[model samples]
Target: MASHVVDDTALAGFRTGLAGDAITPGDAAYDEARTLFNAMIDRRPAVIAQCETARDVAEAIRFGRENGLEIAVRGGGHGVAGTALNDGGLVIDLRRMRAATVDPRARTVRVGGGATMSRLDRATEPYGLATTGGRVSTTGVGGFVLGGGAGWLDRKFGPACDNLLSVELVTADGDTVRASEDENPELFWALHGGGGNFGVATSFTLRLHPLPVVTAALLLWPPDMGLDVVRAYRDFLEAAPDEVGGGVIYMTAPPEEFVPEDMVGKLACGVLVTYAGEMQEMRDVAEPVLGLDPDAEMATECSYADLQCMFDDPPGYRNYWSAEYLGSFPDPAVERFCARAADLIVPSPSQHVLFPQGGAVARGPAEYPIPWRRAPWVVHPFGLWEDPADDDRGRRWAREARADVEPWSMGAVYLNFIGREGEDRLVAGFGPDNHRRLAEVKARYDPENVFHLNHNIAPARGRAG
Candidate 1:
C-alpha cells in the first residue's frame, strides 16, 4: 500500500478539533508513541492521535478516513503481531485514556480503553474486587478482553469476556455507539472475541468479582525432572477445583531470593499454582504437586493486584510466541513437550508453558466466539531474547513447540495467545459459524474494514458500508 502524504493544513485542522494532541513523524514524542511491547516491531505511522476521551477517538477516526490513511488502534500495544501499528498510516493511540472507576456495590469497573491490567487491578483492589485479567500488569484491558482474556483468575471467574458488561466504541464512520446485552445485542455478541474489527473501544464496563484472599505457589525443579513434574501436574489439574489456576512452565530460573544459587540463569521446570483462596487452603489443595520435593519453593499469600505484577515480562526484549490447544495431554505428548524445552534459548526470559484449561474456562458461556476454551490444555511457547541475531532461533523454537503437540491438537486456538499465523488459524480462533456471524456484525459497524489491522474479520459480502 502506498503511504498517503498528509497535508500540513489539513493536519492542523484535524488537531484543532481533537481533545488530544496530533503527533507527527517529527514530533518529540513520536518515537516513544510508536514503540510496542515487542522490540522487533518498529513501524512509523504518519500520525499518532493520543486520544484522551471518546470524543477524541471519534475525531481521530474521521480524520484518518478523510486523509485516506490506514488506521491502527493502539491500546496497551502488547500484541505480538504488532497490529497496533501500521507503516506510514494513522495510529489511534489510546494510552492517554487510562482511567478506571470501580463501583464496589455493583461489582463492576468502567475502564478506559487505554487502561492496562495494572490500572484496572489497582483500582478494584481497594474494594477487594477484580475481574479476569491478563497475566502481566502491562497488558491492555481492551485488546485482552476483546480477544477473549485468560489469566490467573480465569479458572475462578471465567475468561475476561464472560465478565464484560458493555463497551463504548468509535466506529469506522466516526460514530460513537454503545454495545451491551440490552443495547446493541448483536454487536455485543461480536465484541466477545471479535477484537478491534468493528471499531475502537474507548471504554469497557466489566463485571467484577469479590476476591479477598489469593495465594501463589512457585515450585521449581531441575530441567531433568520435567517429564515426571509435567505428568504429575496434568493429573493434579484433572481433578482440581475452580479455585485452582496457573500452569507448568520451563524457564531460565531468575535470580531471586527463593531460587537456589546454582539454579539461577539455568533451565528449570516450575509449577505455578495460583489459588483464589488463602495460603492454607492452597496448600491443602496443591499437596499433590508439592509432594514432589522441589529444589526451590516459594509459597505465600499476596494481594491479587501484587500477584499480577510479579511475572511482568520486561519490555525491551525481542519476542516470538505461539500456542496450540490440545484435546488431551497424554504421556507421549508430555514427553514431546518436555523434550522441546532443550531447544529454548537458555539464560533468557523465554518460557515453555502448559496451562490447564478446565473449571470455569471449559464451563464459560459456550456461545462466545472463543473456540479454544473447551480444550483441556494449551501449550504456549513464549520466546523472549535480547540479541537481534536470535530472532530466527526464537521463531523456530516457538513453531517447533506447537508442532510437537499437533497430534493432540483440538484444531482451535486463542487469538490473544498468538501472532498472525494464517487464515485457517484465524478461522480457528473463532469457529467457522462464529466467524460468519461476526462478519455480518462487522458489515453493520465497519463495512469498510478500516479497523483491519487486528485478527481481522472481513465484512460480509453484499452488505452496505
Candidate 2:
C-alpha cells in the first residue's frame, strides 16, 4: 500500500495474516475479491487483508502504520464511491467477521459490523423483532449506521444510528474500546453519525422492537400518472401513522410478468409501501395511496421477513446512489418531482426510488450529530444495470438525477448514499458540532488517522494534514 506501487515482498506479509485470506493485485482471486457494489469506483489497492476478527483489524492497522502504508477497512464492500477499498492501501476486510447474537427478551441484539441488512433481518425476524435500517436488503451495517440509517420503521423507532446502543471498535492506535452511553461517552456520540473516520467498528449492540407482521403493496402505475402519484404520496406522508413506512419509487417499467407487457421501457411510478401494525390500521392508512393511480398490483399482508427481501438487487449488478433532503412539500412539490421523472427519463427503468424522511428519523438522539435533522423527505436516485456496457449511462443518470432536484434540496445529503466526493460532504453530513466532536474523538483514539479511507474526519491536530 505504498504509493500505488507496492512490490511482491510487501504484499507477502499481508497475505500471511491470521484467520482470513488476502488478495493482492496479481492474485487469481484479486478481481473477484476487490470489487465493490458501485462500479463507478475502480481503485486498485496493493493488498486486501480479509480479516475475521477484531484482532485481525488491529493487526492490519498496526502493520500498515509501522510499514508506512495507506489503509482501508472494508466491511460489506458496497461503498458507492468505493471508500471501503482504497487504491494502494492495505484493506482490512471484515466480511468474514459476520456474527449476530440476539436476546429477544431483552429486546437487544449484538451484530458484527460486517453483517448486511438481510443477515440481520433473518436473525431477528424469527423472534418477531426488528431494527431501524435502509430499505435495500444488501445495505451494510457499518456505513448505514455511521451515516444515520433511514428506514420504514424509523418513524416508530429511530434512525439506525439512534438504535445503536454500543459499539466495539479497534482504534487507529490499535486500542480496542467499547463505546456506550457511559463508557467513552464521547466516542459513542461521535460514532452515532461519524461515518468510519475514527475507527473500525467490530460489533454493535442495537435496540430492537416487535415486528409482529407486515401489510404492504407495490402499487404499479402508468408513466403519465407520475405527477398525481407524487402529490398523493406527500399527503400520505404528512399524516401517515408511525407504524407505516416505505417509499414511492418512480422508475422505468421492466419487461416482466408483473408489469404490463405493453409498457416495457416506458417511464412509470410505483409506490412500494409497507406498514407494520394492526391490520386494519395499516389498511386504513394505505387506502388513500392505493386510490392515487388508476391501476395497482393490489395490497396484501405478508411476513415481515418476506417484506425485507422484496427489493433485492442481484449480487453482481452495478449500483450508483445519490440522495438529497427536501425542505418541505409545499403545494404539491411531489408533482414537480414526477415532472422531472417524466422529462429526463432515468437511464434504467428499474432503478429509482424516493421516500420521505421526517417521522421518527428527524428526532435523533438529542445529542447525536446527524445530518438532515429536519428535512421532510430525502430523495435517493439509484442506477441499476446488468449490461456492463451501460455503466456510463448509469453513472451519468444518477448524478444528473440528483442535480435535477438541487433546487428543492437543502444541500444536505445522506452519508451512506454519498460517493467518494471527498471530506467536504462528510463535514456537511454532520454539521460543525458533530464534525468537531468526531475530530476530537478521532484524535484521542487514532491520532495518525490510520482509518482514513472512509468518510474520514481527521483528528483536531492530526498528521500534517
Candidate 3:
C-alpha cells in the first residue's frame, strides 16, 4: 500500500483546483462518504475527491500519483468486494458527476460515470426508449456496463456493453481521450469487459431500443415444490421466445398483499417471468409456468423503468455473493440446487437463484471478453443478512451452493458476480487469449497499473511504460 502523509499546503492546493469538494478525516461528511453497500467493508480513505467533471477526475489522478497515494474509483459503491475504497489512500468519488443526456432521435443516451441505473432509465422512459440496464435501479451505470451488464431485457436487447457507442476517459497520465470504433479502436474493444484496469471513464454513450411496456409476474410456492417447479421452468424456457426473460429464486417470502399468511418470513420458491410485450401476450406465452397453481401471484403491465425498481435489494446488509455458469441443467443438478435451499438463513434477504441466458446474450458478438454469456444457465448465490455473527454462515451457504453445481460448471464466470476468488478464476472470466490481448491494451493505456483495485489485469511484459 502506498502511504505518504499529505501536508497542509499541498492538500490545500489540490482542493483549490477541483470543481468539487475534498473530504478529509475531520470533515463532517467523511463517514458517510466512505460507507459502501456491504456493511462488512469499513475502509477509511485519506482523502475523498468528489469529482464533478472529467477535468476533476484528471486532477485527482495526477494528485494521487504525485503524492504516492493508492487511488480507487467510486461509482455506485455496490461492489461486493469493496475495492472502491482503500484504508489510507485517495478515492476519486464520482457520485456528484451523475448527469444523463438523452438523444431520442438518434436512439442514444450519454450518461455520466457516476449516474445510476435509475437516472438513465427514467431519462429515457418518457421517450419510450431504453437499453439493457442493471437489475437494480440504484446500480451505477459505469461499473455495470463495463463489467458486462446483464438484466431482464438482455434476452431481447443484449448485454449493456453491446449497446455501447463510445466512452470518454481520463487515462493514468492525466490525458483525456475518446474511444470508439473509429477512434482508439483497440482501447474501445478492451473496455467491453476489461473493467477499470485501463482508465477512469468520465461518460458513456449507449444505443437505445424501442420498448413501450413490459409484463412482470411473480409467482410463489412452498420450498418443497422447488424441484418440480425448476424442472418445469427449464422445459418452458427451452421453447420460450426471446421476448420472455426471468429466473427462479428461493428466498424468504416477504409480507406482501399476495403472499399467504403462513408463507411470510419463511423459505419459498418464486419464479419471475418478465415479458417485453403486453400482459395478454405474456399470458399466452407463459402458460406452462402460469398453470402450476402458485399460492401467491402478482402479474401486471407497467413501464420498464418501474419494473427495474421492483426487486431492489435494500443496502446496509453484510453481503457475500458467488456464481457458477453451467452448460446444461440435468435432473441431478436440479436436485442438488433444491437441496441447498434448506441451508439458507430463514427470514433473510438471501436468494438462491437460477437464471437463463440463451437469447440475444448468446448471439451477441462472441469476441467480447464475457465468456460466461454463452452458458445457458447460471447459478447465483446472493447472500445478504443483518447480523455480524451470521457472516460465516452466510459465506458458507454461498460457497456450498457453488460447490453443489460444479459438475456442470462451464469454467467461465461473470467477474461482477463473484469477489476476488483467484488468478485462475480471473483468467477464466476473460479467456486465456482475451486476457493476453487485454494485458497489451493495459500496457498501452496504464502501464504502471494505477487502476489495480478491480479484477486487475497486469500490463503486458516487455511493453513501453
Candidate 4:
C-alpha cells in the first residue's frame, strides 16, 4: 500500500524508451496535462506518459507497475468521476495519439485511444460515413465506446459498442492483445461495456454506416410548457421509427442566431430531433411534434459530422451528472420528470434531458453486459455550472431527478452517463450475471485490477489473490 517515489534514474530510463515525452510535476506543461474536462477534479500524478503508440502504452504500463505507482489511464479526460487521474501515481496519457484512419472502402474506422469524437467524425465525414459517437465532440473515443456510447445516431446505428469491430489493448502485464468477435472472444465481449477495467485500449476499429446527411430539428418553448411538451415528446417517441433520434431537454437557451432574444439565457424547454434521412422525410416523420407551434424552431439537413458538433457542451464548468433508465415513461413519470426540471439551475448550462432508447439501442446485441440498453427511456441530468457555490444545488437536482423516476426505473444504468455512485450502481450497470462474467474476463486480462480507475470490475478471487 505504500506509495512509489519514482527516482531520477527510473524516470530518466522511462523517458529514454518512450516515443513521446514523459512529463513530471516540475514540467512546464504539467498543469495543462493534468487538466480534465470537469474543473472540479484536481490530481497530481508523479509521472504522465504521453504515449503515441500501442507499444508506448505497453511500456508505460510496465514502468508504472514496476515502479509501484498506481496507474491511471487518461484519454480525453471527460469522466466526471476523475478516475482518469490518481494522486501521486502514474498516468498513461494517450492525448497525443489522436490519429483516426478511415477505410472508406471497408466502411470502418480505426481511431486512436486518445482521439476525440471530432477527430472520428471528421475522419469519416468525407466518406459519407459515421458510427454512434458521444454527443459532445470532445469526448474520447476510447472511454465513450468502451463505456457503451450513446448519441443522436444511436436509435439508428445502435450504441457505439454495438458498432465496435475490435480493440487493440495493452494488458496489466504489459502485453499487447487484440479483442474481436473472432480473436480473444471473451475479452471482446467484456470490452463491450466492461470499460477500462480490463486494460488500456490503444485503438478501436468500429463499423461505420453511410450517412451523408442527417436532418436536425430544434423546437423550443418557455419552461412553463415543460409538462405538456415532455408528455407529447414521450408519446411521440413511443411509436417513432429507428431512424428518429434526439431528446427532450430543459436548459438555459443559448444566444444562437436562431434563438429568439427573449429565450436566450432564460430557462427553456426544447425537443431536438435527428433523422437519418432527407429533410422532407424527416418533416413527414416529425409532423406530430412540429404541430406543437414552438416559439422558436430550426430544422434543416446537415452533414452528420457537422450535426455531431451542434450541441457541444462547453467544458471548464463544475459538473455532476446522473442517469436512470426506465422501462416506460407513463404520464406520471413524464410529470415527475418535468417537475424535476424546476430544480435545475436556470441561467446556467445545465440540462435536464430525457433520451429515447427503444430503437437500435434496445435492439443491439442483448448478450452484451450493458443491461440498460433494454430500457426505453433514459433520464439524464447533466449538471454543469460555473460557480462552485451551486455545487450542492446541482448535485441535489440530479439526485432528485433520479429519485423522482425510481417508480419507473429499470435499476440498470449506463456507466458513462453517471459519475462514481457506488458498488451497487456499478454492479447494476451490468446485471448480476453479466457482472460475474465480466469479472471472470477481468480475471483473465487484469487479475490484479491494475486498471482499477474506471467503472472497475474486480477480478475473481482465485485469479487475483
Model 3 misplacement above 4 A: none
Query: Model 4, stretches more than 4 Å misplaced?
Result: 1-3
What candidate 1 gets wrong by more than 4 Å, as runs, is none
- Give per-residue CA lDDT, model 4, range 381-408, as digits (tens): 9999999899899999999999999999
Per-residue lDDT of model 2, residues 254-355, tens digit only: 666666776667776788778876567776778888766545464667666667677766566667677777887655456556665654344453456677
Instruction: Compute each candidate's TM-score over C-alphas.
Output: 0.99, 0.91, 0.99, 0.98
Error of 3 at 425 (Å): 0.6
lDDT of 1 by residue, 1-465 (tens): 468999999999999998889999988999999999999999999999999988899889888988899999999999999989999899999998999999999999999999999999999999999899999999999999999999998888999999999999988888899999999999999999989999999999999999987999999999999999999999999999999999999999999999999999999999999999999999999999999999999988988999999899999999999999999999999999999999989989999999998889999999999999999899999999999999999999999999999999999999998998999999999999999999999999998888999999999998745
Count clashes in each candidate, considering only residues at least 3 apart in sequence or on different chains.
Answer: 0, 2, 0, 0
State residue 294's C-alpha deviation in candidate 3, in Å: 0.2
Root mean square deviation (Cα) for candidate 3:
0.8
Comparing 1 and 4 on lDDT, the stronger one: 1
Task: Look at candidate 4 and tell me the lDDT of residue 148.
Answer: 89
Q: How many backbone clashes does candidate 3 have?
A: 0
What is the alpha-carbon lDDT for the whole of candidate 4? 0.92
- Between 1 and 4, whose TM-score is larger? 1
- Report model 2's TM-score to 2 decimal places: 0.91
Task: Please give the lDDT score for candidate 2.
Answer: 0.76
